[model samples]
Target: MEDNFSNALLLMGVGLTTVFAVLFLIIGFGNLLIKAVNKYAPEEEKPKLQAADNKAVASIDPAVEQAIDLAVQQLTGGKGRAVKIQRL
Candidate 1:
């Protein structure tokens, strides 16, 4: 019984060590990959927004404008605003 218990404890220690070692290796490799990508590839710049394009909004009916604003608000969950509405 004593020998079996010792063997079990040894196996448990080895298994735990192996698991931690693999976890550390995975984290190290992941960090290395992220650093390599950031060093080699950078993000592109976004296009700048032009001036206000609200000329077409003035000709739209009041009810239509209200409906469009309501739709935009609903779709964006109240986080977005309808800045410019143009007829295509």
Candidate 2:
């Protein structure tokens, strides 16, 4: 009975030590990964300058715009006007 108790105590001590060591390693590795990410993360706001697209859809021409305005008046029960597509 004494031998069994000693063995159980030794096993418990070993298990606790192993758990602590693994926890410490995981925390250390996580800290290192976080530091590495912080060092190289994209913190700069580089503005994406879009090139001006002058291309207009051939189907949605000025004549279609006028038709759209008429359609909007009919669809929304005369509540709103169709959006004007002014060509720049």
Candidate 3:
């Protein structure tokens, strides 16, 4: 009975150690991959807002703007307003 208990404890220890080792290895590899990608990947350029976009937003129909304002007011419990509506 004593021998069996010792064997069980040993098996448990070994299993736990193996599981933790594998998890640590996976975490290390993931971190390394993230660092490598960030180093090698080109930074994306953001699109600049053009003057035409502002003109379009200013030219939006009053009815459509009212609808947008109503939707925003309802969605935000009448605490928010639609300041600018733009098209892509």
Candidate 4:
């Protein structure tokens, strides 16, 4: 009976130690992974003028100016006014 009790105690001690060791390893590795990701993450780049589309506004129709002004006034509760259109 004494030998059985000693054996049970030894096994319980080993199991508890293993559980703590595994938890420590998981926490340590998680911290290392976060640090590595922050070190190598890509930075946000500013938009370049050369990369912008030059013809984005080229398809605007001159006939839609009045309609656009009315829509804008309706949308903005009459606070918006239409500016005079100038032909380039």
Residues 1-88, model 2: lDDT tens digits: 9999999999999999999999999999999989998898744442332224435434356577667766877899866565544346
Best by TM-score: 3
**C-alpha lDDT values of all predictions:** 0.74, 0.70, 0.77, 0.66
How many clashes does the backbone of model 2 have? 0
Kindly list the per-residue Cα lDDT of model 1 for residues 1-88, writing each as its tens digit: 9999999999999999999999999999999989998888754342222224566656677688677766877999866556566765
lDDT: which candidate is best?
3
Pairs clashing in candidate 2? none
TM-score to native of every candidate shown: 0.50, 0.45, 0.50, 0.45
lDDT rank order: 3, 1, 2, 4
Instruction: Name the Cα RMSD for model 2.
Output: 16.6
Between prediction 1 and prediction 2, the one with superior TM-score is: 1
Total clashing pairs for each candidate: 0, 0, 0, 0
RMSD of 3: 10.7
Q: Write the per-residue lDDT of candidate 3 for residues 25-81, one digit (tens) a residue.
A: 999999998899888975444233233577777677778877887798799987677
Q: Clashing residue pairs in candidate 4, if any?
A: none
Residue 65 of model 2 has an lDDT of: 66
Clashing pairs in 1: none
What TM-score does candidate 4 reach? 0.45
